[model samples]
Target: MGKTVLVTGGNAGIGYFAAEQLAAAGATVVLGSRSDAKAAAALTSIRSRVPGARLSHVRLDLADLASLKTSVDALGVDSLDAVLCNAGVLVDGPERALTPDGHELMFATNHLGHFVLVCLLLPLLDASPAGRVVTTGSFVARSVKLDPADPQSANDYQSKRAYARSKLAQMLFGFELDRRLRAAGSTTISVVNHPGGALDSLTPSRPPVHVRGAGQRLRGLPAGLLLHGKDSGARPAVRAVLDPAVTGGQLIGPRVFGLRGKPRVEPVRGGAADPDLAAEIWAASVELTGMEPV
Candidate 1:
């Protein structure tokens, strides 16, 4: 195996494609999905593309902390080269929802759940010579203003804003994680990436009834051209995982306006680069997931 890699939400969309490309590159890829059936199908698909592809499917529901903990522990793996926080949710509908962890759904799945997962899996990652954690962030993070007063969005809940906040949290966590890992003198690398636009399987946060087919089709057109293929979106993530030059606190993403292009080293927005916020989020996440720091 090239390296042991785990990708959350690898059942479909950009996650699936990223897993496919990585598996083809000879990595031992673990597909983490919420649905066992979906994961099985994704594994089958990868095998079809890459003969005898080394792949395994594990159940991981980003909205449920217990599920993540149980599934991760059951993996029975000693070490992991890289763990991709590729799962996400876009709450575009009118209603607001909460995760099983009692957090705002968007924040819980997109940020907190993965936050807990990564921290809990640190031991496995640390065992690798060059362990890395790649998190999928977004351009919307630029627009989001982290409201520490209302981290859960309980008092105020706007669909786009919540989603954006979650992405912002992911970015901040990646940066902060870099600092923490370096301080501990661990070889683990933590980095963030954003696809910029819609990938093949852009899943909406709300139920299907809330989305219009025509609107989704129209939105996906320009996105299809600008957003990038599954492999391209995976570039930054793969690079962050394998590239020796990617240092702590660096972001890897497209060079173009917002989408399809090569992976380039980038920086987190100044407004979003507050160490205080990162620390606060980190503490909050640890409490929320009940996962003690390593």
Candidate 2:
């Protein structure tokens, strides 16, 4: 119970599984969710699986700036070994929804909220011995182009395109974080992971019609036979946070299609390899979230 770890959106899906695995490994797992009931449910589920699991629940809503700060306040301020930014949402409707802070929903929840949380906790993290931050990205990062001038996709918002763009931001943040922290003489590791395509049905939103297309149908075999399990998808994330072999800027995931095979440290996409774009995204994120780098 000494090494502290927090997982945003850890109440369900891949986040829940990651928390469970980390708990089983004897780390204090704090499940962050907007719903207290769901957070309790997640804690109970983890205990049912691992009787000795050290777990707790805290409120965290990525869509609301005040909620983010409130959740950060509720968390016990202590040196954290790692913070897994796994909370994300895929808003697939035609209408563009703005967050409480008046930012795009997908971008705010998937990227900015975690960005704020990481920055707020960076002081505690930097004070720890070998603290780390791990962010969950997606294979969709390959499909989008990051235009700094139009970071929010305000002019054109295609549902799937918006989702892809958010993922790209996630990857960009990971790379830029590593570069900046190293330059600042902080050893905090910033690593990224993608689940490829896993069968995670915990999200409350529906996928856009086009997103539920032929690929999903062809791969509609069996959850076990086709898509990777949440545990399998979370392997790279687990390694990134826990394994000493893992390093900053390393991308981890399965080797096979949709990354369903064994997990390993991998390289991110080339388009997401722009240092300049990453820096711009970092600055934008700080401004958007009102979070200062610690």
Candidate 3:
């Protein structure tokens, strides 16, 4: 039997491709998404690509904390071999939208929601011999200046900054999680990976959203000369979950300038390695989520 795995935002983009890779390698994937229709469509898409793929969908809304609990409860699995915290928000509608739980939308969806989910699912992860959690991050995280004073980014409210802060939170949390797991003598590894500038514009996904391939390729050539499509970007996260060599807390990204290349161990930057900041972020997440993971 294949290992049981779960992936957030598995309905599209890198998450969708990562699910395909995992399912193709023999695993039962419990996909989580906000939309049932999208999840269903994604399942069909995956099945078309990988025949006999074991897949299921769970309705999850990061904006709604109650829904998150209910969604996990719906899954009766006692243990999960791996979980990819792949769901996130980038080009959201509102400039500074807040979740139903009163937290910043991007911060909640990209970081806090995944944080709570991982903590809640620790038992299931512990049940596996070598459980893993891989959180999706981005090169944008390198520029974030996450301030505890403005955790919500309500005052500044720059869309790109908000998104960057959220991504940085995911990276910090991933490292912090591994630290805590080690401190507690657990084997479950928590790692983070970036899709290497995996722009939707360059990828040809079904139902095609944002067809800016030629333009993005031309425009991004200076910064991301070889920017990856989504499938290529998903490779690093998949490796983080499946690779035995990937130790806990290690950062991973595309080798070629983090735009388009093979997955490789990369250095953490932009104050992301500060232990004090990680603890602060953890405390903030726990307070925001209203619960600490066991």
Candidate 4:
């Protein structure tokens, strides 16, 4: 039987490309999206790219913590080889938004929701021979520090800073999960990866899902040397989940100055490897989400 992988936000951008590559690799790719129309569109697009691709979809709204259990049950699989925690919300507006769960929008969707979802799926993940949880972090995470005390960003809520801090929290969670899994001697592993610099202008067209215009292609040419399309950006996460050589607790990203190139194993930077901070963040997550993965 082929491996089964669930990719959150697989309907578009980096997650979409990752799903396509995995499907082409013969895995059953389950695209997690909140919208039925978008999921159907993505399924068609992927099938167009890779004929006879095995695909499915589950209604997943990461920001709505109340609905995560229903979403997991909707996966309709007993075992999952991997869960790509790739769905995220980037709130760039000046006004800080909150999820239905009352947590910061970005933090809830990007970090806490994934955290709870993984916790609920632990049993299914453990059933696989080598189950893996791949967290999709960001390049911006490399510079920000997550304040465990203010994880929701209630005290200081700059849109950009809040977004960066949420990604940082996710990276910390990934590393800390690896540590916990190792301590428990589980076969499952956790890995963190970041897409260096992915832009729509640089991305190739995937009709019905994504279509880059001629003007966009021309505008993206100059940055091509240093920036890449979302397709290239999807590589590190795909490598982390599918590559046998990738072990737990490792950070992976682009090879060239962490900007744009082939995916490679990179050092964990920006306090992502700090165990104390990770533990603190882990505690905060548990408190905020009422879920724990161990």
| Per-model TM against the reference | 0.88, 0.90, 0.92, 0.98
Q: Is candidate 1 or candidate 2 better by TM-score?
A: 2
Q: Which scores greater on lDDT, model 1 or model 3?
A: 3
Candidate 2, 1-294: lDDT as tens digits = 356788988887778878878998889988889998888877877887888888988888887766666787788766889999999998878999898678999998898888888888888789788999999999888978978777889999887898888988988898889888998999798999887677643212122201234555445555556566566677777777888888898888887764587778776666678888888888888777777564
| lDDT minimum window of 10 residues, candidate 2 | 202-211
lDDT of 1 by residue, 110-147 (tens): 98888889977899999988888898888888886887
What TM-score number comes out for model 1?
Answer: 0.88
Instruction: Give each prediction's root-mean-square deviation over alpha carbons.
Output: 4.2, 4.8, 2.4, 0.9
lDDT of 4 at 229: 93
Whole-model Cα lDDT of every candidate shown, in order: 0.79, 0.80, 0.84, 0.92
Steric clash pairs (candidate 4):
none
Please identify model 2 stretches exceeding 4 Å from their true place: 200-226
**Which window of ten consecutive residues has the lowest lDDT sum in model 4?**
95-104
Query: How close to the true structure is residue 139 of candidate 2, measured as C-alpha lDDT?
Result: 89
The prediction achieving the highest TM-score against the true structure is: 4
Off by over 4 Å in 3: 91-94, 207-224
Model 1's alpha-carbon lDDT is: 0.79
Per-residue error at 234 for model 4, in Å? 0.3
Summarize candidate 3's per-residue lDDT along 223-266 as a digit string, tens digits.
Answer: 44678678889999988888889999988899998778899999
